[model samples]
Structures are given as C-alpha cells and as structure tokens.
Target: MSTPQNLKLPIPDVLASAICAANRLIQRLAQPWLVQLVLRLAIAVPFWKSGILKWHGFLQLSDTAIDLFTQEFQLHLPGGPYPFPAPAVVAFLSACGEVTFPVLLVLGFGTRFAAAGLILMTCIIELTVPDGWPIHLTWVAMALAIAAWGPGRVSIDYLLGDRNARW
Candidate 1:
C-alpha cells in the first residue's frame, strides 16, 4: 500500500526511534503486582467485611432478611427466596465462600475463578436481591480484572506458574 503523500514520513528513523522509546517506556510501566494489589484491595475489603458479618451468624441480608431485620425498609424479591435455607448450613457455606473468596482474591490466589464466583454471587445479589449495587460493581470490576489479567508477580498463582492457566 502506498502511503498518502501528506502522511508520508520524511525520516523513517524518527518513527523507529520513537517506537523503540515507547516500547521501553511500556516495559518500565508494566507493574503487574501494583495492578493486582489495586484489584485485591478495592475488591476484597467490602467483600471480606460483608462476608465476615454473615459468617458471624448475621444471616443472609437478602430481601427477606431486610424486611425481617428492619421494619423501616419494606422489601420483596417477587420470586426470590431468603438468603438462608432451613438447613442453616447452606447459609454457612455461602458465608464462608464470601469470606474466603475475598481472602483468596486479596492474596491473588486462583484469582480469576475466585473472582468469577464472587462476581456471580454479587450479580445475584444485585439483580435478584437488588440491594448490593455498589458491592456488585466492585466485585464485577475486580473479578473481570482478575480474569483478564490473571494474578501478578506477587501472587501465589504466579509463583505456582498458573498465571496464564485458566480455571
């Protein structure tokens, strides 16, 4: 393809030198650990706190729980069930998942799948339960980052050579 005369370069060396400099700059800026750290902190704090509350027997804070817990806020799921089941253990498991997933995410361990699970749960809370928009947003963003970037050099996934491996 012929270059447009107006766009033609007078000196290809200038372009080549610029390109090389840009490449070096990119490598210097490629701090995967920093990116992962941001992902861990921004995503995990709320999750860990919320999950810890539930783990401490707070029960599911879903629509049913909201209505029951605070009369000030009327709540309904329309077709939703409570966060907890009759067995109690199911709720416990959910709590543990929420609690532990954040820890794993913070540590960048199996980040993608962990983030994916948490993201699914958050989407359920946001879409089905309708009370966790911000939290869901946090999870969705971080989960996506984890899935997109994999864990960083600071992560167990990286140390174990699973950074590029998918769940």
Candidate 2:
C-alpha cells in the first residue's frame, strides 16, 4: 500500500471547529451545581438581610419595626372602619419566615419548601406593596427558578436524597 498523504484542514474549517469547541467548553463550565449554588445565594441574600433587620431585637420589639408593620404593612379588612389589627404578630411571623427559610435555602436543606415559602411571602408583599411588583417579580422569578430546578448535587438535600422534594 502506498504511503498516505497528510491531510490538511482549511483555515476557516479549523476556526469553525475551534469556535464550536469553545462553545462546548463554555457550556461545560456552566455546571448545574455551580448554577444552583449561585441561585441559592442570590435569592437568599435579600430575604436574609430583611430578616436580620426585622429580627435585630430578637426578644423585644423595636419601635421602627413595629411602625413598619403597623403603618406600611397593615392589612385592611372591609368589615369595620377599624382594621383587624395584628401588626406585631404579622411582623414577627414575617421576620421569622424570612430568616428561617433563607437559611434553609442557603444550606440547601428543604430548598424547594424554602423557595415556596419565599414565593408566598413575595405574593403577600406584592399584594401589600403593589408599586414594588417589579422588584417582587424579580424575587419571584429567582425563587421560582429554585423551586423548578431544585438545589442540585451540591446541596444537603441531595445528600439526604430529598433534592427532588419540590413540595
């Protein structure tokens, strides 16, 4: 058999192959675990900050916190001229929710449940603060993404085999 000639690829073909390889490399670099970790952190930060602010005075109620719940976040009932007042209770519950759920999310324990709670919290905030829908929608989208995609393999839930627990 005659010796085979060395085959040479065209310059454009080589460039195209390089580009394709780079595209695949980028896609591989965007690992699901890393993405989930980012999502968890991104969505958790705001809630954690809000929670920390609200719970600054753990045992005692701060006047500023009270004022926000009473004045800014009051729920008006149609029944009476006076409202069904539970500002302190609502504020405490909300603060607890924000803190607890975000911690769970960041830890990747019960991520889906945490995301759902955040979604509910977002809904309440939207209803109460309609003007802030844009911000709330962003929060909702992040939470929804977590809820939909789950915590991935980097999570405690994955270790515990609960990563698929979207409820």
Predicted structure with the largest lDDT when compared to the true one: 2
Candidate 1 C-alpha lDDT tens digits along 99-132: 8888888787877788888877776557445666
C-alpha displacement of 1 in model 2, angstroms? 38
- Residue 119 alpha-carbon offset, candidate 2, angstroms: 0.3
Once fitted onto the true fold, the runs of candidate 1 whose alpha carbons sit more than 4 angstroms away are: 1-30, 57-87, 128-131, 165-167
lDDT of the candidates, in the order given: 0.68, 0.82
Instruction: Please give each candidate's TM-score.
Output: 0.61, 0.78
The sequence of per-residue lDDT tens digits that candidate 2 reaches over residues 31-126 is 878888898999899999888887556566567777888776644335523322698887787888889998999899999999999999998877
Shift in Å, residue 38, candidate 2: 1.0
